[model samples]
Target: MTRLYNDPQAFADEMIDGFVAANSRWVRRVSGGVVRATRTEPGTVAVVVGGGSGHYPAFGGLVGRGLAHGAAMGNLFASPSAQQVHTVAATAHRGAGVLFSYGNYAGDVLHFDQAQERLRAEGIECRTVRVTDDISSAPADRADQRRGIAGDLTVFKVAGAAADAGYDLDGVVRVAERANERTRSFGVAFSGCTLPGADAPLFTVPEGRMGVGMGIHGEPGIHEADVPSADGLAELLVSSLLGEVPQSVDTVRGARVGVILNGLGSVKYEELFVVYRRVAQLLAEAELEVVDPEVGELVTSFDMAGVSLTLFWLDDELERLWGAPCDTPAYRKGALEPAELIDDTELAAETAAEIPPATAASRQVADVAVAALATMSRTIDEHVDELGRMDAIAGDGDHGIGMQRGVHAAVDAARAAHAAQAGAGTVLALAGDAWADRAGGTSGALWGAILRAVATEVGDERVPDAAALARGMRAATDAVLRFGAVVGDKTMVDALVPFADELETAVGDGAGITAAWARAADAAAAAAAASADLMPRMGRARPHAEKSLGTPDPGAHSFALLMRAVLTTTTNGRNAS
Candidate 1:
């Protein structure tokens, strides 16, 4: 359990500040995260890696020479916002380009891809190589769908080394892909992790039992079994990985590999050493040569009592890169020449965008929008724990906190835009940006898309009507569908699509906006409730589908709740404007 925290919502930001202050020599403060304080070679490709905040050394800790040039740190258990990623990449880019790498998760994919598009639009070359090295997340035939784990170290190390060795964008991507293809990892959990201020752990394992193939994010494991002795546990981990060796490696005999016995958190070094002790014997027995093996925490999941084993199969080039001298806040290796520190220390954050002019009617609608946003903030605050409890059934248990962060930011932005005399559309759009930027996860991105899509339909000059809102809802549904989740995927799409369809149908039937919206909210609520029976086919919960069978998806439930909450606020005949 996490004991020390001032504001749970402020934990990630506070932690980053303290970390930067302590590691100023290796990393300097940037808007999104830390960039290497040490100067890099001109024209070197900047390797920017990131994900959620709970994983130490994985993201921020790896920023230094011969590793990630910068890392975009997000809230705990949330992916960094697209704005954050773009900011870090822009700052880190030397002259060659930027290579983005991180664990293969849905939120990370969405935000990082968005950032990549933005960078390319500005003529800064950007490429991404998602780390899909966790063997337990997916089947061998569908390896690309695997989520990354401790194997992230191998990919990042090789990418950083290749970038520093003067590889261009293409060359860096190629080597990074090579490293990803050659790595495999498996993990087990003896206990669940507790988020700060949470009443209980995300998911608890039975006493004397261990969860096999557990995710680093407190996702329940594929199976559970009686905990075994250290040697027995090592045998299980080693044999499991050995059975699923990468296709590139024809055989395990005589293959040189880089091994990492990573503690997920709360697993002390001595325990990890005991497990690695037997892991080493097993690898040697299988005739594999180990090089530069790491036996400590690299990637962690807060206080999860879990450990993962990663085997990075190394060819000649990869071996040299793995052995390259490097320095970072964490995970320093062989000595290196003194690095020059960067001179410019100023960090000017971009402020709220200027508000566009609005018509009187539109400004009236903007006032209503601001009020609706406030209602949403209050609604989320009231039901945050309920939403989080639902998500914790099969997720990392951060849904409540993520929503709290997003809705609060949305409310703040909407209030600011209203004060600036912005239109309803402009206010919602700005609020949406803040929601996504502050929340930094799947829910955040979806809400942002939904708001922006709705904003486009009701421009600055027009007062939003029933038809416009129905159309906006349809467009929002389309935006979500583009992310590849369907109605039965046990995601927000399950509730949102039904609500949009119901709204359009009701409005087309000449029903008033109030009636149509209420009807749509009812439909959404039903869909969200029925989601309790559907297996999760998307996002982090997919790995623990069985565990979610009787629970509604947190995303779907939250969307439904938010819809209902907004409906109540717009009760002046539901056009509100």
Candidate 2:
């Protein structure tokens, strides 16, 4: 369990600041994550690797020479927002293009893909290679759907090494993809991890039992079984990974592979050495040559009692790249000569954006928006635990915390904007940015989109009527749909689409905005409940779709709850009366 935290909502940000402070020689705090403190040669491919926090040494810790040029760290167990990724990539990019790498998770895909598109549009040339090395997440035929676990180190290391070796963007991408294809990982947990201030861990294992095929985000394993001895566990992980040799590797015999025996969190180094002893013996008996084996907490879930083994099947080129000299905060390989430190001015200071002027009518509307946000924040606070419980059934249990952080940030931004006499549209837009920036997950991105659409419809100059609001709702629906989730995908879009449709229908028939919204909220609530019957077809829950059955989709449920909460604001101005 997490024991130390000043504010659970502020944990990630604080951790980043502290990490940079301690490792200023290797990394400096950037807007989103960290960048290499040392200067890089111009036209060198900038390798930007990252994912959710709690996996140290993996992200920010890996930022330095012969490693990641930058890392886009997200909130705990959540992928970074598109804006976050863009900022890190832009900050890291020199004359050469940027190479973005991370775990193959839904939120990471959505945000990184968006950021990639944005950079390409700006002619910054960005490419991405998602690590899919977890054997438990998908079958061999669908390996592309697997999650990235501790094997992320191998991919990141090789990519960074290749980039430092002066590979162009295309070459760097090819080598990184090859590294990912050649890597395989399997993990197990004796217990789950707890977030700061959370009453309990995300999931738990039975006493004397171990969860097999566990994820790094405190996601429970695919199955549970009695705990095995060190030798037995080693046999299980080794045999499981050995069964799926990359097609490029003709056979396991005589194949040179780099091994990582990673502790998830609470597992001590001595205990890992005990397991690795058996692991090393097993690999040797199988006639596989181990190269530069690493054993420790390379990637972790906060205090999770878990371990994962990764085998990177290396060819000649990969071996060369893997042996390259590099230095970073957490993980240091062969030492290399240090370069000049980056000037402070080279880094941009994060400043609040100035709000555009608005009329008194628009400012009045902004005040109403602020009140609605306050109500939404309260609703999230009340239901946060329930939402997290539902999400924990099949997904990483961070929904409640993520929502809490996002809404709190949104509330703060909206209040500031309202005080500055910003228009309703500008207020909502700033709030949306804050939400996505702070929360940083699929839900955060979608909510930002929803708010941005509505803000556009209700511009700073005009007081939008019901028809305009309905149009904004329709636009929000389309914005979500563009993310590729359909009506039955068991995402927030499921409830959002129905709510928008119902509101549009009610407004078309001459109903007031309040009445229309009430009807829509009713539709959303019903849709959210009906979602209990669905097996998640998207997002993290998809891998354990069966487990999610009979539980309402967390995103949909939260969306419904917010919808009804907003109605309270409409019923009574400021929802305080």
Candidate 3:
């Protein structure tokens, strides 16, 4: 368990600050994360990598002369926001373009793709290569769905080396993609990790047993078994990977591969060497030549008692790139020449936001929106522990925190907009931006989309009626569907769709805004409770859906709670009138 923390919510920020302080020679502070302190060659393709915090050397630690130009750090176990990614990319881009690379998780994919779109819109060439290298997460037929693990190092290393070697945007992307294709990893855990200030671990393994194919983000393993001896464990890891080599490789025999025996937090270095001893013998026995086998922690969960092995199949080109000289705060290979540092004056200046003009009537409605967000903030705070407990059943236990961060930021932004005399639509839109920017995960993105959709319908020109609100709810449902979910997928959509339908029906039946919202809230609550029986078909929780049986989805439950809270706020307004 994590023993030290000033405040649980502030852990990630504190860690980044300390890291930058200690590694001043390698990295400098940026808005979202750290960029390389050292300057790069002009026109070189900048490699920007990122993900949730707690995966140390993986993201921020890798920012230096020969690795990632910058890293967008997010809250623990959550993907960085799109705004974070774009800020890092903008700061890192030299003259040519930028290449964004990270693990293939849902939040990471959503945020990185959004950042890529933003960069391109501004005429800055940006591309992305998602690393999918965990063989245990999916079948070889659908390898693209695999989650990245220790193999991330191989892909990032090669991509960074390629970028350092002056590859253009296309060339860097190709190398990164090829590296991801060649790399494969599998992990096991003796115990689960604990988040800071959390009273219990995310999951637990029975004594004398181990979890197989677990994820780095405290996700429970797919299977469990009695703990094996060092040799036995090494054989298990090796055989599983050898059974399904990359499509490009005909056979493991006579192939040269880069090996990584990664320790996931609690595993000591001596234990890894003991396991690697057997792993090395097994590789030789299989007639594969091992090149530059790394045996240490490269990526890690907070304190997970686990380890993973990665194999990067090496061709001539790959071999050269793999052996390229590099230097970073965490990992180093060969040697690197000294580089110039970024000038103090070259840092980006903060820009002020330009609020659109709003009419007086619109400003009045904006006050109501601000009040609604305040209600949401209070409601989320009240149910945070309950929501987090539900999410901990199968998913990462951060939904409650994410929602709190998002709604609080939304409330703050809404207040500012209302004070600025902005329209209701502009207030909600600004609040949505803050929610997404501060929340930095799947829930955050979805809520942001929902708010933006509602804002479009509740324009500044008119007073939002029950019909307009229903239409906005319908649009919110559509946006959620377009973001890739259906009613039975066991997501928030299950509750959202019902609420939207019931709201439209209630409004059609001549209900007032408060009445319609109260009815919709009831529908959403029923739908959310019903979701307890559903097996998840989407998101990180899908693989372990069975474990979540009889527990409501955290997202669905939170949506229901938010609906009811907002209903109360509206009803109160009506009573006051």
Candidate 4:
């Protein structure tokens, strides 16, 4: 069963019970799990929000201090009943009035509309503000119908601040609407989520793919695409948001802005920062001044592997309210220095030094290696499913995917260069470029560094024998460990260290190049298999400690597999001769 709950009805009750238990001083359930927070001052404009239960700190948990005055909790992935909405509104209503704000979803509209009518009959002045910031969800002419995601926080923050500042109901509603207008959000989900008591996820996404425009409650996305690097994904998300809003501060006429990088449940802070680095770069390029930036799980779907980006365009009034003190369990504004540009001169010098001068003989060897790696790319791809499933037992299941993607990209680069010029060294240089360009994450960078180090060693050489190959392997190994810091960490080093050691021993024993390669490959494969019993000592799996036991390190396994493929191909060629 995908969900952990015992039954469907018990889901709502359990959630409300926990919420009130934890926040008894500020919030309580009136009826049907409709949560209300006592206003600090009576007759102040009441800001009410409600939505499905899974989006916590959204409509409910946001109901304190400088946020919502009342939160009408709904069932899992379902809108609250009209009765529940009305009950919460009545409890929060003072002599002044009430303002209802929520995402632009069909169920929300239906229930909130019913509650508005009922509250008006009881002499409570009520108004509604809809959050419609997802540009991917609707056409330009119908942007008002877009779904709200992380942008809800900006709406509630500005609206609640208005109410706290003693704005009347109409004024509060106006400021809330203005905040909604200035905000835009978009999200990409790598996987779906399961609701309480459900046997299946609310939606499904194919592995190694990302669904752009996926909804908060595991709704299907607008389209699915191959998962790109964090930088590429950040560009896609930020560009889409900028397309909807103004691209520059000049276009916004020097308006202050707030950027929120929100993780949907399961994405960790490390991955979020990878995405945020690109986001800050993009915003600076656009010349927009970020008044406040937030990064974390402000809103989430249960265990969804995804992230959402929200941008709030700010004027003087919104900026003042944004800076207003807020002390909540989830939202906070801390002191931050202005963003600064990073110096790239050192990086430029390093890149120039890394690129080797092209030569004919070196090109041929590089081409052959790239082709060999490409031929084994499918093997890596096939292993990804098994590796991921195994990793889920102990580590995150990304090893197979990462290696396959990095190798395929390297192979494609080599083939393209070989096609352009049949010469040998051109292919190797091209493969190195491809590996550097397409590979991502720590493994990708390490793999790219290894290839580049090999290229530098073989620069302009027509033929590399056992000694030259041994030298290149040693250099590559040193570069990988230097950059990755995975030596003796039970990672790829398990396979790589043995392979390098065997190659050096074979060379000292005067073994032929082919014999040395065969022995090294076998030793590497054996070392990789033996690592299954060793504990993971590095990367994300380190925290789990013993959990990674019995699961072979993905990096080690890939290295072993690649060694086997290269050796098998070389030995077969010798036998045929």
Candidate 5:
């Protein structure tokens, strides 16, 4: 049913055409499908890299200012031919010479070796660096036999920096080899990817099972295990990496380390953070000093569900290189800073003391709010079909499902807090935990943070009047805006901005809490309705801004409903009193 090209040769050519077209500033195709980018410092030692084509940014995207000078691109899952590698090396070679680097795959080795010989015969000096970091691909004693994973980034950066520093060809090759020696990576796949127009996936795994040691190109993993929670997954990955590194308190006492939490594809950033939280704790337990941690979709397989961890043991020189100023379309290394020394005991104590206690009245409010939210949760779930359909027109379809999960978790936590007779702050804390656990998206996390901010503002208040409510709303709005840059950009702000404004107006008019809430709810609903004609300017939908026109944002609609429920409840309570 797919209209995309099924032929690997055709697909590869088309992809390379599009890639070169979009990235002319950084890359261009040379003879034999070799994409080469001009070096930032011409006449410096050149780094030529390559791998299969499907891994977009890898090998290809790395060819830029502070990374590889040339990339030999191949067909999806297939290595570039010897001519491709030779052409890339020839194009990238400076008078200083060229260093060839690539993952440790049979075909890559064979092709790159052939290219190396060809380049040498042409009177161009050349050497090679192979990355073998995937522990799953080889035995502990044979780690050098494993295929490369995400650690390719480290090799490229280190080698590129060495070359930029005026290292000769052999010296640059040594730096790259050292990077490959010190760096390690491992990955697990939750799902497989489809190859272009293939009717079936390139490979298949059982449902709810994760393929450990899965190759990025759909090769069989070591084994499939039952899917684990994000925390569990992080633990698994951290344990494996730690085993390889074998850190002792003494070994890590004064050492700085770089931790990279990379998503394969389709794994949400929120989920990645959850994994990072656990990984951070694990590293701390091992007493390894974390220098700069990066978490995101750095290397991806097309639509595959998986994540990989890359650990680079940092030395003073490597640290300097890692922190060196470099810029590319996908990666940028900001200015470097000295690692801060943190006392573990002090950190633990501070965290414990910062958690505020919850009160009885706060628990009551939380209980009622939870029940109301739970009832609304079903509404969110039911509307998911519609929401996903709407989102598919302009953005990803997870918005509705993400919200439903988040609201349900928040309600559930509120119920638990109420049963435990938690104080106001504690109830809010519980709500935050629930939000983080269930929301699994940027908006959900933003909403959760907003709730926690409001709870912190309200504190132990037994009865929040119009002024207090207004202050709380203002705090919540500020928190959301701080967490995400979507406010005033046609996101939930379409409804929330009006709700806060109406609340302020009501309070200024000397309206009671109930009346003010009612006014705010009406304004929020009206604003949400009005947003149907506005264009989205934030989030993933922003890129397709025109497509979202004439449709109300799901976030705005949800905000309006929440305000309506709160207003209705407040009015009923006032009338009963």
Candidate 6:
């Protein structure tokens, strides 16, 4: 359990500040994450890697001379926002291009892809390689769906080495893909982790029991069994991984591989060595040659009692790349010559702000938006515990915390916009950016898109009426669907679609905005409850879809809750007027 934190909401940001202060030689603080303090060749390809913050050495620690040029660290167990990714990439990109790499999670994919599109639009060459190496998450035929675990180190190392060796963007991408294809990993957990200020673990294992195929984000395992001895556990991981060597390698026998015996937070190094002893013996008995072996924490969940093993199959070229020198804050290999550092003044420039023009009438409506946002924040705060409990059933238990952070930020932004005499559309747009930028997850991205769609439909040209409100709701639904989910996918879109349809119908039948919203809110509540019967087809919950069968999706439930809360606020305001 995390015993120390000043404020739960400010944990990630504060942690980054302390890390930059401690590792001044290796990295400097950037807005989203950190970039290498040392300078690189001007036209070299830049390799940027990152994910959620709890995975320490993985992201920020790996930023230095022969590893990632920068990392866009996100909130705990969440992916960085697209805006965050774009900002870090822009700061890191020197001249040639940029290569973005990270775990194959839903939020990371969405944000990184969006950032890649944005960079290309501005004439900066950008590419991505998502590490899919956890064999237990998906079947052999669906390798693309496997989650990236500790094997992330292998892919990131190779990609960074390729970039450091002066490979172009295409060449670096090719090597990164090959590394991901060859790497395989499996893990187990004895117990789950607790976030700061949380009273309980995200999920728990029974006494003397262990979870097999557990994820790093405190997600429960696919199966549970009695705990095995160190040797027995070693055999479990080794045999399972050897059974699925990549098709490129004919067999594990006589093949050379790089191995990482990674500790997932609470597990001590001495216990890891005990397990590794058996692991090394077994690999030798199987006639496999192990190259440079690493045994320690590389990627980690906050205080998780678990460990993972990764095998990276290597050919001659891959061997050379794997052996390349790197000097990061946490992980270091062979020595390298000293490099020049980036100037402080040039790196301190922040992202440029945008203020769209607005009309006088729309500014009055902005005040109303501010009130709605404040009410939404209070509602989310009230239900945070319930939302976290629901998410822990089949996903990472951070939904409640993420939503609270996002809504609080949105409320603050809306209040500031109202004070500035901004229009309704501008206020909504600014609030959307704040929510996505601070929340940094799948929910954050989807909600940000919904807000932006509504903002576009409610421009400052005129006063927004029921017809305009219906149109904005419709646009929000469409934007969510096109972003990555549909009604049956068991996401917020399930509730949102029903709410939008009912609202449009009510307004068409001559109902006022408040009445239409109330009716739509009821529809959303029903849709959210009905989602319990569904099996998730997308996002992190997909791998454990069966486990989520009897529970409502946290995303859908929160959306419905927000709808009902907004309806009450709007209806009360109308009655008073």
List runs of model 6 lying over 4 Å from the truth. 574-577
What local lDDT does model 4 show for residue 395? 44
lDDT of 4 by residue, 205-313 (tens): 7989998887776555667899999999899998888887633234653556899999998899999999999999988888778877988887788778899999999
lDDT of 6 by residue, 1-577 (tens): 8999999888999999999999999998888999999988898898999888898888999998878999999988889999889888998998989999999998888888888999999999999899999888889999999899999988889988888898998999998999999999999999988888788988899999999999999766779988999999999999999889899987668999999999999999999999999999999999999999999999999899998999999998898989899999998999999888778787857754566667877877777778888889999999999999999898988899999988999999888877777888988988998898888889888888888888898876567898898999999889878777888999998899999999999999999888888899999999999999999999889988998998999999999999888877777663212
Model 3 CA RMSD to the hidden true structure, in angstroms: 1.9
Candidate 4: list runs displaced more than 4 Å.
Answer: 1-3, 34-39, 246-254, 333-577
Q: For candidate 2, lDDT tens digit of each residue in 1-577?
A: 7888998888999999999999999888888899999999999999998888988877998899998999999999888888899889988998789999999988888888889999999999988899999999889999888999998999999999999988999999999999999999999999888888899999888999998998998665789988999989999999999988999998779999999999999999999999999999999999999999999989998888998999999999999998888899988888798589999798866777999988777787888889899999999999999999999999988999999988998999999988888999999999998898888888888888899899999878777788888999999899889988998888898899999999999999999888889999999999999999998888888888998889999999999999999999989954211
- Writing each residue's lDDT as its tens digit, candidate 1 over 413-464 gives 9898888889989999999998998899898889999999998898788887
Lowest lDDT 10-mer window, candidate 3? 568-577
Candidate 4's C-alpha lDDT? 0.71
Two-way lDDT contest, 1 vs 6, winner = 1
Local accuracy of candidate 5 as per-residue lDDT tens digits, 33-86: 533344344578878888766675776777666667778876555566565677
The TM-score measured for candidate 1 stands at 0.97
Residue 3 displacement in candidate 2 (angstroms) = 1.5
lDDT of 5 at 105: 66
User: In each prediction, how many residue pairs overlap at the backbone (N, C-alpha, C within less than 3 A)?
Assistant: 0, 0, 0, 5, 5, 0
| Candidate 6 structure, TM-score to reference | 0.98
Per-model root-mean-square deviation over C-alphas: 1.5, 1.5, 1.9, 23.9, 23.1, 1.3
Q: Pairs clashing in candidate 1?
A: none
- How far in Å is the alpha carbon of 429 misplaced in model 5? 71
To one decimal, what is the Cα RMSD in angstroms of model 6 from the true structure? Answer: 1.3
lDDT of 5 at 379: 66
Q: What TM-score goes with each of the models? A: 0.97, 0.98, 0.96, 0.57, 0.56, 0.98
